[model samples]
Target: MAKLYFRFGAMGSAKTLNLLAVAHNYRQQRKKVLLIKPQIDLRFGANAITSRAGLTCDADLLVSEKSYFTLKGNDLISHDSLKKDQKNEIVLDNKLDYSCFLVDEAQFLTKELVEALYEITILCNIPVIAYGLKTDFRNFLFEGSKRLLELSDTIEEIKTTCFYCEKKATHNIRLIGEKPVFTGETVDIGADEKYRPCCKMCLHKLKSR
Candidate 1:
């Protein structure tokens, strides 16, 4: 039976790099892999799935909160609300041709979308691998990650060291310039200049200062 797998970690953990490597291995074996990413992640580009390590790939599908999925015959079709023309709907038909479904930045996905991916694993018999941060900078579980933790057949952690020390990083700290700030919007998208991965002790020290 195919399984829904969630691999989550703090920032700079190379989650997207790992995802790219998996996609590479599948394609190398002559198997088809579908790449998916949330529409909210524009850090690279609208359709680009990029890693900090400089590896990138265009996502096969971009999903938003308004997107939905349905199975037709052997095909999985996604109906997206990205178009302003109400009469013409945009559809992505996945004819069950792919051996696996790989989603990047899975934390930005809506709960409904995660459930749809889960259904694909069971009904379509395709394994789905989702890579993302488990929580936001505030250390709160993202809606998508929360559902994945509850429903995923397997949950794994991708490890990375704290920015200040060698301890394993467990939390993401948002920064403006060089100082850590605790209060802000939950969904601020940024790279190294705006965020740092910190262990529990380092986080406490920074917050105490």
Candidate 2:
């Protein structure tokens, strides 16, 4: 049976790179892979799924909080066709014959969307791999990550070392002008300069200062 897989890591753990590599492997084997990303992640571009190492690919599907999915025969429909009100939803007429579905920045996804992806894996018999940070800078579980942890058939952690030490990093520290700050909006989108991966001790040390 196909499984819903959640691969999470702290900031700078190369989650996006891993996702891109998986997609490449699938395509190299003559299999189709669908790339998906949350519409909120515009760090690279509106539709670009970019890795920090410089590799990039256009996302086939850009999902938002208002987006939902339904299987219509062998195809997947993004919005409800019967519902006359399609206000903020993205409508897509895409076939669901892909061998795999890969999602980047999965933490930004809404809980409802995560549930829909989980359902797709079972109903469509297609494996879904979602890569993202397990927790926010505030050490809180993201809505999507929380649901994935609960529903995914396989949960894996992509490991990386702490920025200040050789120990493994388990948390993210939000930064502004090289100084760590704990108080801010939950979803401040920025790359390397804005966040640092820290271990428990280093995180606590930084917080105490």
Candidate 3:
């Protein structure tokens, strides 16, 4: 049976790059893979998933909190592919569509949307690999990440180094102009400019100063 896999990491963990690499591998093997991202993540642009390293790919589905319900049945992916006139249609043998579902920036997904993704694994019998941060800069669980932690068939951590320490980074620190601040909006999005990964000790030290 296909499984739902949640791969989580701190900031700068190369999650999107990993998603793109897996998608590339599937295409190279002549298999269908569906790339998905939340519509809220527009740092790169609508329908685009770009990595810090410059690797980029257009998303097959850009889901919103409200629109994610479309994943039920054959409507969500197949219809969108047709509407976009995408060259690489997800269908196989004129029936099955997308052997795998790969999602990036999954932390933006709503709880209901995460449940829908769960149903896709069971109802569609396809494996789903979702990648995103496990927590916000405040160390609080994102609704989608919380659900994923509870429901995913498998959970994996993508490791990265702390900026100031040798221990594996587990927390994300929000910075403005190189100054770390604990007060701000939870969902402010940016790359290296706004967020940095840190270990528990360094996080404490920075917050204390």
Residues 1-209 of candidate 2: C-alpha lDDT, one tens digit per residue:
78999999998999999999999999999999999999999998899999889999999988887677755532233444435454344433364678999999999988878877887887778899999999999999999999999999999999999999999999999999999998888898899999989999999999898
Could you tell me the TM-score of candidate 1? 0.91
Q: Residue by residue across 133-176, what tens digits does model 1's lDDT show?
A: 99888888999999999989999999999999999999999999
| Model 3 lDDT tens row, 50-118 | 999999999987776555344323443333323343322222233237789899999998776687678
Task: Please say which candidate is ahead in TM-score: 1 or 2.
Answer: 2
Query: Which ten-residue region of model 3 has the weakest summed lDDT?
Result: 86-95
Predicted model with the maximum TM-score: 2
Each prediction's Cα RMSD?
A: 3.2, 3.0, 5.6
Candidate 3's TM-score reads: 0.88
The estimated TM-scores of all candidates read: 0.91, 0.92, 0.88
Better-scoring candidate (lDDT), 1 or 3: 1
Total clashes in model 1, counting residue pairs 3 or more apart in sequence or in different chains:
0
